[model samples]
Target: MKVGYEFSKESCEDPVMKGELLLLSSVMFLLYVVSGCPERCHCHSFSKSVDCSQQGLVEIPSDLPPQTLTLHLQDNEIHQLPAFAFRSVPQLITLNLSNNSLSTLDPGAFHGLQHLKVLNLTQNSLHSLENRLFHSLPQLRELDLSSNNISHLPTSLDKPWENLTVFAVQQNQLQQLDRTLLESMPSVRLLFLKNNLWKCNCHLLGLKLWMEKFIYKGGVTDGITCASPDTWRGKDLLKIPHELYQPCPSPPDQVPSPAPQPGSARGAAPSLPEDRSALAECELKAKPRPANLRYAIATFIVTAVVCGIVGLMMLVATIYGCAYAAVTAQGHGGPLAPTNQPGKTAGKELLDSPAA
Candidate 1:
């Protein structure tokens, strides 16, 4: 009987041990398949995606395969992109580097990335981007920079970027954007610009017209609300009354108007000094201004607003003080204004103090 009991217990333990062995073998096989990735990354050749998110990476992975199409490096500690960082991965199409510490980009950061299409740089510390950062990326389409310290856009954005369709710059420090920047991006259909400090004033008139055209063309914009000019603050820029931009000056078309010769009669309007000034101003307004100039102008406007408010307050105080003194003088039975009914000093005004 004892021998039979022992045999039954052994029989039950044998199957348990075999099951554990099978599980361990499967785990080893999975690790082998994932061996293609780096120490902290997970690479899947079948999916052509390499996931290295939240890996505490201070720099880009050195061993990423050239066959990788979708590379995820979000939630890393990478700061300041080096030039040609992606020179080896011409095949990469989608790259996710959001939630990093990138502040600046080298001019040639994306050199030779001809196949790169979608790039995510959201939630970084980027204040300004290099003008030529994406010079060689002919196939790039989408760019995301939703949460950053970007106060001004790169001047190069006024040209190139032909295939881009989605541009997300929501929740930045942008007070104004050059309409030419939007005009240059003729292919963009969806623009995210919510939660920005957009100053709606005469400076924003051009952008409003562009927005109207964009809306007509079935483009999408999200909550482009104004944050300045006390009257229009918190108002949706697109919904503002058109009369607010009264006497809207149209930009000078690229097709030049026929210039008048010295004796021409009908074409002399454009040659007038005022007309020339208007055209020049419109032309300058139509294009993107230098970043430094825009910032200087923005600063000047803010300073002027502050000074105006202070001056207005002072003027009100002075008027009130003078009125108060006049009323007090009348109550104290002091000199009143001389009657103008052919009395003394009627023609000469008040030559001296008048009797009460």
Candidate 2:
């Protein structure tokens, strides 16, 4: 009776264990079916992370894991990016939408990603960007807009791209950049402007002066050439390195006229002479003044010394020639006054002499 009871209890526990194992297996299979990515996107999921980049996606896909923080959609045919394409990624820190066909970025496109950093939009077809397009991403930093077709920048842009550093806008079509655009970005360093059609003009006077005043220099030195007006084409602006936008100078031949007011002193006068004088003073102060007449005098002295040395050499040669002539004259005195012997001529007797 005891053995029968023990066998029955063992049978009941074995069936319960088998049932629990079956239930666990079924739950695992269901989870795999639900969380796994579809066939279109070649995704690899491990534990709680997913990687779905370079899958030839035309648009931002739906049904991505909500906990995914790293989204890499590089090298695709994604042309138009919806405003809320990244809205669901709350924890996303790194977003790479590089090497795509993104032409324009609608304002407020990058929203809901407060912690996002390091946005790379390199190698795209982007031409123009709105001023407030990046208004929402205040915390964004390290933006790379290299190798794009961007031409213009907002003149009145005064926002802090918060904690921003390393702004690269190389290989673009930027014609002009306002010097004031760099005033608000005090924290920014290392601005790249290579390979662009920079139009240097009177407006660029501000940049030229700014770089001189603060002892700061830019990186696009020789590459910043003039593009417009048909005169400055193919000419590098920095090669001249001269200040362009200075106060207008008076005509060289024009004379200063008295002030229109009768009793006005020169202090209050604003004639072209005063303006030109002010400009001259500013130029002298800004750039080092050229060496004065002393340099010319020294150069003249050196030339005179060289000429004097050459003349001395010629005089010495003349003296040597005269001495040689005098010695020859003494040697053939009077041509050995007609040799007494009829057989020997005067020239032949002198030639046959011991000295000869």
Candidate 3:
């Protein structure tokens, strides 16, 4: 019984030793990685201003040196952003956190960042953005949220950032854009909406009209197919054309169709078949048919066949006529061989020999 107990104790000690070894190996790897750490904690400097952003940082280090300005933390495995991460680095102007595994941004993520202007959060796996996430960064100008899993822009994010100029939401799963969302913005200049799954239906007509008038088009390419089938499918809608969105008439009892939406119209609907047939006619008339080549080929073939038949008839007639002439001459009298004294020549040689 004592021996069994001793053996069990030794086995437990073996597992503990293995755990310690793994922890020591991890520490060694971390030391090797941060061996070339900058003068300050968690900050590596290439020059007086440039600093590494998120270089395998599990947490924000103690302090960053004064000279660090632009921080690049893109393409990291950072899951959560601490509140005071950039407290000491107030001089950082450009913060790039693109292509990271960041799932959540704490409300106080950018608390002390007063000088940050351009914040790029592109290519992240963000599902939803907190409305008050950028409340601290009042001086932000460009906020890029492209290539994320965000389905829609928050309607309450109206006054989050006042001076935002460029708002990029390209390559998202947005089916429609709410006009209220646009109204919340403070006069955005460049709005990118390409490569999104925009449902081109009656409800989305307003946004399309806005895009058409503003010329800030959606759809990166013609391959940006429609998301719904009620009206649109394999169609490419960049800026809604004026002709394509005629309104359907409303009954007297029914409420009037919402007055001329952005991508819609207020007039009567034109016949779709008429438009298609007109387009077909236009296309048919635009291209000239190769009737001249067809004519040339037909003439050449007919002439060749006629010439072959005439040649064959002429050859057969010549053969038959020659045979008939030969028979006729044989019937009358055999045609004499052209010879000078042909029968007498042999006899004349005998006569001459006898004389000699």
**The candidate that achieves the highest TM-score relative to the unseen native structure:** 1
- lDDT (Cα atoms) of all candidates against the true structure: 0.81, 0.68, 0.67
Assess every candidate by TM-score: 0.60, 0.55, 0.50
Candidates 2 and 3: which is better by lDDT? 2
Q: Whole-model lDDT for model 3 versus the true structure?
A: 0.67
> So what's the TM-score on candidate 3?
0.50
Q: Report how far residue 120 has shifted in candidate 1, in Å.
A: 0.7
C-alpha RMSD by candidate, in order:
20.0, 17.7, 25.2
Worst 10 residues of 1 by lDDT: 280-289
Query: C-alpha displacement of 204 in model 3, angstroms?
Result: 1.8
Judged by lDDT, which candidate is best?
1
Clashes found in each candidate (C-alpha, N, C closer than 3 A): 0, 0, 4
Error of 1 at 276 (Å): 23
Model 1 over residues 211-327: C-alpha lDDT tens digits?
899989999988589888677778898887665554435565543766667766863566434454355342112223346878899999999999999999999999999999899
Say which prediction, candidate 2 or candidate 3, comes out ahead on TM-score: 2
Error of 2 at 12 (Å): 21
How far in Å is the alpha carbon of 214 misplaced in model 2?
Answer: 7.9
Q: Answer with 1 or 3, whichever has the higher lDDT.
A: 1
